[model samples]
Target: MSELKLNAIDFISFAVAGNTFKLKANLIGPNDQFHSVNLDIAPDEIKNKTIGEIEKLALQALRSA
Candidate 1:
């Protein structure tokens, strides 16, 4: 066999609560165990607000930036 060796790897795993989750980022899972995960970005909660309110939110971000 060649002398090359595996020195590092990238992995991910996660656990969840009622509506929240704890993601173990950059984690190396056990060799015999299988872990699967999916990523999602929750939609913003601003949909029900008025357009003026949304405009206000935009300005707020510009001010912060």
Candidate 2:
């Protein structure tokens, strides 16, 4: 499958109780269409992760959608 291109990542909010993060991802689909997706991330999920790694995760999710 073709990879989705990540255009931007925006911070939406944080849940203090669960320590979860809400992010908005702006991506370019494989067909060159633009898309915006919301993602819920746990602390463990992002620990020591690079921006590229996060982008890969978003791309994977978008491809499966």
Best by lDDT: 2
RMSD of each: 17.2, 2.4
- For 24-63, candidate 2 gives per-residue lDDT tens digits of 8888766678877777789777677687877777777776
Q: Which ten residues in a row have the lowest lDDT in candidate 1?
A: 1-10
TM-score of each: 0.31, 0.69
Tens-place lDDT digits, model 1, residues 1-65: 11222222233223334332222212123453332222221234423545444334333433354
Stretches of model 1 off by over 4 angstroms after superposition: 1-44
Model 2 residue 24 CA deviation (Å) reads 0.8
